[model samples]
Target chain A: MTKNPIVNGKLVCVALNDSEQFNAMQAEFAEAPYKGAPTQPVLYFKPHNTWSTDGAVVEWAEGADSMVVGASLAVVFGKECCRVSQAEALDYVEGYTLVHDFSLVEQNYYRPDIKGKCLDTTAPIGAEVVSIADPQALTVITSVNGTVVNETPVSQLVRGVAELISTISYIMTLQPGDVIAVGFPGQRAPVAKGDNVSSVIDGVTKLNNVLGN
Target chain B: MKHARVLFNGSTLDVTVEDSFSETGQLKSKADGQLINEADVTWLSPIAEPGTIFALGLNYADHAAELAFAPPTEPLVFLKGANTLTGHKENSYRPDNIEFQHYECELVAVIGKEGKNISREDAMDYISGYTVCNDFAIRDYLENYYRPNLRVKSRDSLCPIGPWLIDKDDVGDISDLKLTTHVNGELTQEGTTADIIFDLPFLVEYLSKIMTLKPGDMIATGTPKGLKDMQPGDTVVCEIEKVGALVTNIVSEQEFYGDKY
Candidate 1:
C-alpha cells in the first residue's frame, strides 16, 4: 500500500495518565491543573515534516544513538468535526491506524522539547486505516529486532476515542485526514540504530520501519 | 485598506480589500476592483499558509505578573500548528469539565519578506502588516509538558486571527497602539503595546536569528493581563487601535460538538 504523504497536516498527540502509574509522576506538579488528575487531556504535536509511513527509515543525528518509540493507535477523522459530543464522536472517525511516535527520551518531562520529538521521519503511521467500532478492545505492540519491547491494551488510554474527540474539538475543528493519537499507556524504551522497529495494533494495522544513521 | 480572503460564492476563496466597516461591511476585489458584500461571504485567516507559528510566553510584564511568573529577560518561544488558525467571526471551542479557559487578545505581526539574521532596524521592514487575534487558552488542558501545550494553545480554531490585514504603512508607530478586548460589550482587557517587554522589531530580529521568517509567518507577540473565562454564545471582540477589530463567537463543547448521535 502506498503510504499517505503528510503535506503539512496536523498530528496531535496526547499524554497517558493511567491513575496508578501516572499519579506519582504527576505529583511533582503543585499547580492547579497539574496537581490533580488531569481535568483536561495533556497534548503535544508532531508537525508535518516529522510524518512518515510504513517502510520508512528514520536517521539519528551524529552522537545520537537511540530514540524512544511510542507505539499507539491514531483516530483518523472522516470529515470536519468540531465540538462533538462523546456519544457522536465515533461517528466522525473514519477508522483506526498505527503510529510510531519517535522521540529522543529526555529526563526533562516538564515541557516538550521539539528537538527531542519533532524530527524528519520521526512519526511513521500505517498506510492503511481499518474500520473498528471499539478501539479500546485492541492491543498495541512494539518490537525492535523482532523482540517485543512494549505492549499495552488500548483500553488503558486515559481518554478513549469519543472523549478525546469531544475534548479536542472544543478548541478547533478536526478535518478529514487529521490524526489524533490516543496515546501509549506506559513508558517507551529506547531502540538503537540498524534496528527494525515495528508497531502493530492487533487485527487492525501493522507498521514497519528501520532506524538508520 | 486591508487585504482579506473571503469565501466567495460559497466555495471559492478570493482576495479582497476591506474598504470599510459598518453594520454591513464593504470590500473591493483585489484582482478586478469589483465590490463585494461582506455578509455574502465567509472570512478566512488573511494569510492562508502561516508557516511555523512562533509564539511568545511572558513577553509582557503584566501577563507574567498575572500568571505569577517572573518577567523573563529573553523571549520564551514555542511553536503552534496551523490547524489552530481560524478566521475572524469564527467560533472557538471551550470543552466541558474545566475552568480557566480564557481569551488573550493579541497583536499579530505577519511576516512579508523571508529573512535570516534580520537586524532590529530592518526587522520592521520584513513585517508585511498587522492583524488582530484572540489566542484563546484552555487552561484546563494545561500540563507541565509544555507552557502552551497543544491541548491548551493549538486546538483547532483556538487562534482566531484577522478581520483583515492592516498594511504596515497604514498603521504608524506599531509600538504605541492600544489593545482592548470586550466580552459581550464589557471591556475585560485593556493594554498598550508600549507595555510589551519586547518590542516588535526586536522580536522579529530575535526570532529570525533562530529560524528563518518566511512570508506569511505570523508572530503572535503575546497577550496582556485582564484574563477571564468566557461561556458559550459569548461574543469576544478583540480590537487593536489602528488595526481592525476581530470578533469571535464562543461556543460550549456540547453546542459546537453538535448532537449528531
Candidate 2:
C-alpha cells in the first residue's frame, strides 16, 4: 500500500525542538555534566514505513504498557525552497496538516530510540491538507476514547512554519510535497491497546486511528 | 568527464557526460545511448534515490583531536535523512544567531551492488564510484544526545555531494588523494585520505555487517581536520584529488518566523 500519495519520493522530517517544555521534561538530566537545551532543532527522519493513514489499526508492540501520541502539525512545501528568508518562508508552504506521531513512550531523549520511534505504522497523517491563515495561532486537541486529554497552542512551538522552512532550508533544499512536522510539545498523553485516538487541529485536519493489541 | 544524474526532458536521467566537470556538459544516456540537451535541466544529487545516507563522525585522527574526542577504534556512524542531500551548485545555509557553521570535505563511496556480511577484500567491488561531499555542520545545535544531532549535521540541504561520479577504477589508491576545501578563494581545510581512521573498504565492510548495503547507498568517509565558518555569498569548494571538485555557495541567513521562543 502507498504511504501517502503526496509524500512519495519526498521526505518526512521530524524536528526535536529544544522548547521550554522539552527542557523542563529533560530536567532529570540537570545533574553534574549537565547538557542543556540544544541551541537549535534536532532532526530525525521517520522512514516511509512508519507512515499510516486515518482509520488504520496500528499494532501495539508486545510488552509495552502504552504508546505516546506525538501531536503535531506539518507544513507541506508548495515549491522548491533553499535559503528562504523567514519573511518569505510562509510563501513556500502549500498547506498545513495534522499527524498522529505515535511511538512508544521514550525514555532516552539524547539519541532517538530507534525501537520506540522507528516501528512500522508509527506515524498517521491526515489526508486533507488545508491552507491556514496563521499556523502559529492554531490549536491541537488530542483525545483518547472520546475524552479530551491535551490541548496545545501552536504558539508553544519554539519555531513557527516560516522559521522552520528558512532554518531547514539553510541545511537542505525543501522540495514541493516534502512535509516537516513542526514538533510535538511537552510530554504527550499515554495511549494503550484498544484505544481510539484522535488528534484534531482546527481548520487543518483531524487524524483518527485505533491501537490494536 | 564521467557518470552523473542530470535533469533532462523533465526527468532525471542516469547519464555519462562527455564534457569536463568544469565546463557546460552534455548527456550520453545510459538507457538508449542518446545524447540529450544538458542546458535545459538541473543537477540532482548523484545518488538521486538513496536509501540511507551513512555518515562518519570524527573518523580522522587529527579531526578527533581538533574536536577533543579520542579517536574511535570503530566507525562513528550516523544516519542522515535524504533531505540533507543536495546537488553541487546548490546552497548550504547558516542560520541567524548561530556561532559556528562549518564545512567538511570528504570522499564519498557510492555502493553499486547490495551485499551483507561483506568482507574487506570484496568491499571495493561493491563500490561503483567516488564523489566529493561537503558535510556541513551547524555546531550550535550540537547536543550530547546523538552527539552530532540532526540539527547540527542533517538539516535540510546541509550535505552537498557531487559534481560527477568518477568510477572507482579512475580514482587511484584512495589513501593517496588530497582532500581540500576552499571558501571563496582562500584555502582553509586541507587533509588527505591517508588520515582517515576507518578507511573506505573497512567502513563498507563494517557497515554491511550490521545492515544490508544496497545499491546507491553512500558512505561518506570522514573529513580531515581544517574547518572554518563560512558566510553568505561565499563559495565553498570540496575538491578530491583525482575525483571531482564539488562546489557549493553559502547564502545569508534565511529568515524564520516569530521570536525564537
Q: Each candidate's iRMS in angstroms?
A: 3.9, 5.3
Q: Which whole-number lDDT from 0 to 100 does residue B24 have in model 1?
A: 41
DockQ of each: 0.28, 0.20
Model 2, global lDDT: 0.77
Q: Looking at model 2 chain A, which ten-residue stretch has the lowest summed lDDT? A: A9-18
lDDT of 1 at A34: 49
Question: What DockQ score does model 1 reach against the true complex?
Answer: 0.28
State residue A169's C-alpha deviation in candidate 2, in Å. 5.2
- The TM-score measured for candidate 1 stands at 0.78
| Per-residue lDDT over A1-213 for candidate 2, one digit per residue giving the tens place of the 0 to 100 score | 236755544445554552657657566556423366555556666655567788888768656777888678878888887767999989988898887777878776665445566556777777877888889888888899999888878787777777888877766667887788887856678988899998888646898989988
lDDT of each: 0.78, 0.77
